[model samples]
Target: MKGLLVFFFIFILIGPIVADVPVREEQFIYSIMAFNGRDYSRTFCGENSDTIYLIADQDNFITTSKTLVYYWPITGDWKTDTRSLNYSFEGTLELTEKRRESRIIYPERYTFYNVKGEYEQNWKVAMGDEADKAWQHYQGLIDEYWQATYQYEQAKMAFDLMVDELAMKITEMRNDGIDVTGLVEKLKRLGPPESPKPPDDYIVPPMPVQSAFILNLPRGEYNICFINEDSAVMESSEKRVVVFEKRRADGIGFEVIPGDKWTRPVESKRSSSVLYVNGTTDLYLRPFFQDEYNDLYYQRMIRNDAKGNPSLMNWVYIQQVPGGRIEVTKNNHTSAILVEEPFYVEQTKGSALGYKIVPFDPEGAHKDRDPSLIAFKIPITRETSLIKFELLDNSGLNMAGSSRQVRVIIKSRWQPILLVLCLLPLLVMTVVRMIRSRKYSL
Candidate 1:
């Protein structure tokens, strides 16, 4: 009886572990490019799942593909091996929503791209021949960019050599006691070769595909299944769809951009959180308009099996607030009014590790390079302390709850305190041990 109980307990433990090693099996998967109120994200529904969540009143895309599907036990989500064997199905998707009869939708070419606007994105989608034209135009632009890049590379190489030659000539003239200031002026006139500018293709156009069934529906429960060309519903294709709505619109947040690393930023959704800065680099804080939604619904909409709190809320960044000023106050005194400006971060030369953030002007030195980012530059000094930031609308009205505290930290100044704190623990231990020894002896 003891041996049998041990066997049962071991089986119970290892049964889950064995089951979690999911084998890749052939199945039909609904590959999707779902819009989550803010942006379009790529996710999928497979044989292992029966539901997909999406936001309403927007166009969401779906297409069927026969591929090797498997459960990713770690993430508790289904994944597909599309590269191995991905086969498309020729069928129509039948959607049955509440109070509506089942309607069939056909797949067509579709594409989307964000055109221009330094602070915000203008994401636009096109379908049918328009999508085809957009895709072709984008591809043509990409090809032209590559060709221009090759030419620019050659030009840059020549420019660098010319600069080097000029430097050598200046050295030679100086050694020979000849004035070379004119040559220096000529070198200055010969600016850097303009870099090849890529197209304004902030594009997330469909890849490995150019067609899908576009589903733009209102908020309600939906039933979706693939129907074959012969008007027969495919097996394992039926799934439930939960179309949810955003809870709160007009939420406020800041897209916190740091000085040194602009590409990689730490985003804080909490409006009450303090913005900490170091003395060395300035920060570019971009205030954004966002919407609030239930965390559970939002995450599940993005990923099939994502977990979140129903009570907690999430912020969906909708757009960058156009034309605003950030008021910087120190000790309750208005210090400066920061206006929106473009800035460029130039990386230091070879073998050195640092960056310099400077005001970006398209017609200036960075004319050859694109503006890294645009925001209100928060210039910090050594004496900066407890600074308050207030966001104002274009009409000069102060946005409520948008106020935040900025604290400048000098990490080096804490060294002495940290050293003393570290030694205090050892000091206490030594004194206690000595006192105990003396007491025991007495």
Candidate 2:
């Protein structure tokens, strides 16, 4: 009788497997945002904004091989500019039947845990089978993500470069009494560069130099040529060749003149710095560049007041903070101090939260350093603004161990989970009936 009972149990389990038809379903999401130049039209200079037409496409998608069955655009107002329009393009687009595949697995899984805090997913397939499928799916997803990201990033960089070039060209042209706006449009129409120059290339007409500026060169026996409009060359004077190395002010970008002097630097153990000022000219700052080694320095340009001009006794201020000491120095000259310890800051809306791992090891690499050093800024909203950071290990696994601190603070206004809750009883009844039907052989 015991053997018969075991046989019945095995048969019941196998029956469900035999009757099961592998139903499969899949969903994919692809998104991108690309914006180019805008175009506008105007009839008269009445400041009529109505005549302006802004033309730029954003958040567009295209499936080359498949015909879209259904798709709807989610149109909305621009978040940054209320006058501008925005299109989210977030709806799912179903492809035609011709694009449907013969076999598709349901892209879903259930999570379980043997330990109270451990999270694991159990798929319909065995361990190896699920892993292989997941690997393939994720690999494709990653490739798609990276390709889109690279293209968008390159386009953005190119646009920025073009803008900077245009700005520089406009400034130069305007200084020469030329119509800079007209030149700007002409450059835009010229578009990309061509080898050997186009047959009808629009060349910039040469303009005479109205103002000449000279740089203070080192004392040297030198041969210099200045080519003017008449191709006339003017050459040299015998200046003493004094070679005194200024060290190129190692890693400095710009120098401050007396006028742009900042306040004195403050000597402090904490993170703070101070500088004093005694000048009245424009302060120029530039980005510092170093060799292959990533050495960094801050450079300031100061313009000094001419003789008899009012002295800037307290115009400039500068400060520096290092670990625990706070040092203040005056007159636009100071040394940069390295930060020896991580700074602790409180979390606030729109402020980046800071953390540092304890028991410091200074020589460790970035990855080997304490996980606490990773910081995340809080995302702000008109509603609740909160920032959350998840600390993951080298294996992309969360380290919080289901702690209360990891909980999501904001409760979403729209609760789709409520629908699942409502249908729970129905799902339970159907599952119980299916089990009973197989067990009773009815």
Candidate 3:
């Protein structure tokens, strides 16, 4: 009985030894230079057999109906392509009631390249898997639209035109006696517009959303949020705020005076904590002062710190993983480190696609660094909060991209529970043994 109790205690103690990958820390990169709709980017890599990566989570993606126009350089005209094909997906978000925002995950990834516009006939099939699959799947679905009888004759005419175009191509191929298999192989050799080639490199840009959060953080206790929505529950808040002193290059020290410059912290009736709203909050927000710092200071600082290590301009958030290992990365950057307490490495995403991102507390958080960049992270605690973010170009004008609110939930310390469970069984076993010994002795 004692041994069984010991075994049970051991099992409970060691069962959680393995740690899980931080899903909240997970991020995606995007491009901003030339992007579609709203100018705010979303949608990572278009689903392709070559570049599409299957991840454990696709919840961030949303399928919306829309038309996508990609300019075919060969045609020298923008093609308005419609289908069930164009689906947009937002990364994740955490919106503060104060209306101030930063992004956790960038909703879009993009690429920009000069197209020479030269391709074989079969090039259309090689553009991307999603493009192809969507084409075929949608063709069948839309075929019904073309085949409609009676009152839907107008829509049918449009469908008939599409069929006629396809038939013309098929007839041309047949008249030429083009060996379908051999011709496909020849086209494969020639490849498509988006094929992997040198000189004209196709780039996938970094996606960083700009977002802000008004967490109901209380003093004396740290809160960790896996942010989704509804900040009333302490465990449901995803936004995290880190208090830091901003130091200017001139060595001037200033503190963020909360008021009209910023929103007054509202007290939470549920937890009696303070919360900030997204738009209404009278929070500290000073515009970028050009005379205060050099325009190149931010990237220069990163480059200096990186020391010729290929660091790029980006907003970075740091989080302490289990075992006190810290990982710092921009939502727009991609590199993984697992070895040291605080590890640093350099990585690259798409081209130099510019974005407009505005800092919430420009005076508080934006002084020391480049006014164009902002960074924050959620601290670990037994609570949750919602976080929303968006990314824009340096102008801070247009929304380059945005993330949906990510719910961050902090977990309680398991040490106490582990101790109690460990000891309770031992105590029970001891009592049982004592009672059994008395009976045996009798």
- Candidate number with greatest TM-score: 1
Error of 1 at 260 (Å): 6.2
Model 2: per-residue lDDT, tens digit, 261-323?
223212211111112222222222211211111011000011000122222211111111111
- Considering TM-score, which of the candidate structures 1 and 3 is the better prediction for this target? 1
lDDT of each: 0.82, 0.28, 0.30
Model 3 residue 25 lDDT?
Answer: 19
lDDT of 3 by residue, 1-442 (tens): 9999999999898889965422221121111121111121233221110111111111122222224444345544333344423433332433232344433432222212222232211111112244345345445544554554322555556556655655566568979987466544444454222322222211222122222121222211122223333423222223232111112211111112223222222211111222333322212211111112222322222221112222332222111111211122223343232221111112234685332223334356444443321222222122324433322223443222222222334445876988899799899999999999999995
Rank ordering of all candidates by lDDT, starting from the highest? 1, 3, 2
Model 2 TM-score is 0.17
TM-score of 1: 0.65
- Estimate the TM-score for candidate 3: 0.16
lDDT of 1 by residue, 43-128 (tens): 88887778878888888889898899887888767788999889998989999987889888999888877666564556778788
User: Candidate 1's error at 180, in angstroms?
Assistant: 25
Q: Find the 10 residues in a row with the least total lDDT in model 2.
A: 297-306
For residue 233, what is the lDDT in candidate 2? 28
> Which candidate number would show the highest lDDT if scored against the true structure?
1
Candidate 1 overall Cα lDDT vs. reference?
Answer: 0.82
